[model samples]
Target chain A: MKRLTRMQIPYRVWMFLFIVIPTLILFVLALTNMNLYQIGAFDLTLDHFAIFSKNEIGIAFWNSFFYSSITTLICFLIGYPVAYYLSTLPNKTRKILVSLMIVPLWSNMLLRIVAWEKVFTADSYFTDLTGISLNLIGTQTAVVIGLVAMYLPFMIFPIFSVLEKMDRSLHEASKDLGATDFQTFVRVTFPLSSSGVISGVIMTMLPAMTSFVLPARLGLGTISLIGNVIESKFMKEVLGSSGMSINEGAVLSLFIMVLSVAAFMMITRVDKEGETLI
Target chain B: MKKRLWKTRAWKALGIVLMSITFLFLYTPIIVILTLSVNSSKRAYSFEQFTLQWYVDVFRDPSITGPIVNTISIAILSTIISTIVGTLFAIGIHSLQKKSRIRMMILNNVPVVNPDIVTGISLMIIFSLLSFTLGFTTVLFAHIFFSIPYVILNVMPRLKRLDPNMYEAALDLGCSRYEAMLKVILPNISTGIIAGGLMAFTMSIDDFVITYFTSGNEYMNVSTWLYAVLGRGQSFTPAAYAYNAMIFAITIAIILFINLKKEKKGKLA
Candidate 1:
């Protein structure tokens, strides 16, 4: 056992190098004006903080929050019942259905986003077949629909797994105690699966909150999330755009990272082993 | 009693309908992609006719083939490396005291939960800070970094389920520690390792955000390639749809095979 501990040293070093160091660098970059182009003129300045006050940044933040919240809520409302129903399913049926849910995830996400873009756009293949032109591109509804389609599985699996592994006797016990089906669920099943619900919510919300591609495609330049801002900033630096600021991107990244860590800490409080994370 | 039974039947029908709708929502985009793959139309906006020309073009086009090759090669390399290293890490972590194990799990999760944009940007920052050029090697490193945690998490649960005395018994039977690990431990946890490898491959194959930041001017996987094509406002060859459809078909086949095999094993048992 003691000898085996040596194997972890390498992984520990890898983690430190990649995870710990980069996060520290992000924090430092967020606070200072230091960037790739001007590495020698290193000085701490809180100037990047002013971006938070910008109207665009505030709107981007609000859009991220609003869209992600709606996406998560829709996923939960759809997912929880679906998960509960799936949990009641026979074994072979349940397995097949669950795999069906996950198959879309295995597809290239960008391609799927593009597919939705086609469906939402007017004069699409869908319209060619159905004779109904949606022309929904650039709408908030399109982005939300794309998001829910992409991430609903994240919501379902956690709740389903928790419910599947839940003590079946509890439901029976509640029934024997004269609880109605609704009472049994509300008092027994839902509370027990709350951890899974939390896990599912966080999983769905985090990705939805940070998603850039869906908004870029479905929103069609009408919508911008914080993620799109970060992407453009980094891309600008890469493209050598004039007035490129990686530091501003770093600030936004740090803000998102803090939100993520806070969400993760909530998960740890409920699920110590970090199970259901998948 | 009749009214209650009628209500229960109604609820069941509603449940089935809801499930059907959710599944329909999930599969609609995939169905569209599959349809568009063989559509004779060059543009995804409208269907011109039915043809398999795009499917043939998938193998013929350089841009399409190049990204397909990159996506597979990176997924393969990262899956293999991460599975091996992550298995060892899981075993190592399994040997630790409780406090350290919990701490390590928290550290393991940073990559797992961190937003892809942040992860990409942070890694991009660090690579530039180190003066390491971003391209194939950086992309490979980034894949491996994010992937190992999944492997570890998948393998950890198996390690927990293993009998504590199995290794000791192997040792008492004259097996060396290395032999004990190989003959006793590895065999027991092989399923977890395989699942983890599959997961790593899945993640790597589909990744865009991290690869986008780290891929620099040289490398492009399918997702990043699609992003680039779309970013330029160019209508890409429908070969992309063909490629994605092929992947979907292959994944379905693999999953069905796995499930069928599991069913056979269960019946035999």
Candidate 2:
């Protein structure tokens, strides 16, 4: 074992301050009733957990869950085939296709969501040019479309990379067993790609469930996701005099944190060693 | 057998069709935005001519330009900071025992896997708890915080592949620890370091949620700015589209040029 060097100390401090302490603070804040003004007389309570029972918050949770799962399902339906096809392509073309998928992922996502929002907006260029109206801007459908577009690349990359690295002999052996192509895919390809599917679900689902921008923009501020709820709780003057207090926001934020952590654990459990990650 | 062959061919044709449609779906937004940026038509739907007027407007507009400058500076500064800190942390953790290393790695994944919203609010909580005003400093700190994981992920793999003897060999030859690191170890991880830095830079620039939470009311990166105006119904000008179009064009050209150059070198080699 190497001796601990002095070089590790500063980063340890940095980590302690930035990473470790902030997480501890999250838990502490969640359990305690401390706000900006209530520095003293701190008492632990789970009452804020009851905030989830509030009709609006509960609806937002369900809305986020519904939209995110549907988005994940749609991304899989679209991405799985794209991933499989790309994996079978010649190496050069496969490389190009993979890079093209990643290209959009790098662009500023806010701009993309805004651009997508226009498709459903009144006086939209799509409607104006095609003589057809989407008229869905303020609807949940618009928000779902925006989420899918924003996260589509995330779904594709995970599945494609997993498929790319998968041993081809499995498929070939299945074919030698007198199975049809669709049978070979269903029995062998799909089962083997389950880890990728799982990872893609985690990748797409978490972001979708917690997405604030899409619902804010495409929903035209009419719809709220779990993320929007959290944002408003903190960002709005919802503390001290007239706003919802801090501890309640922490409870919601902690709910999201637990949801993602569970997803991460499920992912790690499936691929225990992080092999499925792109 | 003959029927199976025909079916396979049919499937291939279907595959091509599916691929084309998917490509169109993926490419439409960028193409549309780029076109809209240059479209000279008076209406949102009209594109009777092409002009660079929006690009000019984007450059001249103080509100947009301020966010642009802020975004670039924050991105660059956070990238540099994260690169240095993350690379150092990666080295430290690499030297640790296996159990601690794995534990540290999982802890590292927390921010990566945590939804940005949760991370944003938690940090926001800490800042307000400490009575630190949410502003540029808080946003930059948040960016650096979230960015370190990317750098560590990139660097860790390279560190594991490092030749243990190189540093020791240099040390045995009378080089000090720092000198050995500088001469022997640094070069090995340079590629990983640069890649990590670039990823961090992009993540910083593309970030909105965390910045939205931590930037308070004063600072607005291009993302937060666009998102703010976007919520106000068509508060976005075509100029915003022009800014991103220029970015997309530059990114594509650079990537293509690099790919082509690599291909040519492969042929020559």
By lDDT, the best candidate is 1
For model 1, the chain A TM-score is 0.96
Candidate 1 residue pairs in backbone clash: none
Shift in Å, residue A164, candidate 1: 0.4
Deviation (Å) of A134 in candidate 2? 2.6
Best by TM-score: 1
Q: List, residue by residue over A15-50, the lDDT tens digit for candidate 2.
A: 677656767777776787765445777788887787
Q: After superposition, how far is residue A12 of candidate 2 from its true place, in Å?
A: 4.4
Docking class of 1: medium
Candidate number achieving the greatest DockQ relative to the actual structure: 1
How big is the positional error of residue B228 in model 2, measured in Å on the Cα after superposition? 2.3
Q: What are the per-model numbers of colliding residue pairs?
A: 0, 1
* lDDT tens digits, residue span B93-150, model 1: 8888888988888889888878888888878877888888898889999999989999
lDDT of each: 0.88, 0.79
Candidate 2 segments exceeding 4 Å error = A1-12, A129-132, A173-188, A237-243, A272-278, B10-14, B41-45
- Candidate 2 CAPRI category: medium
User: Which 10 consecutive residues of model 2 chain A have the lowest summed lDDT?
Assistant: A1-10
Worst 10 residues of 1 chain A by lDDT: A236-245
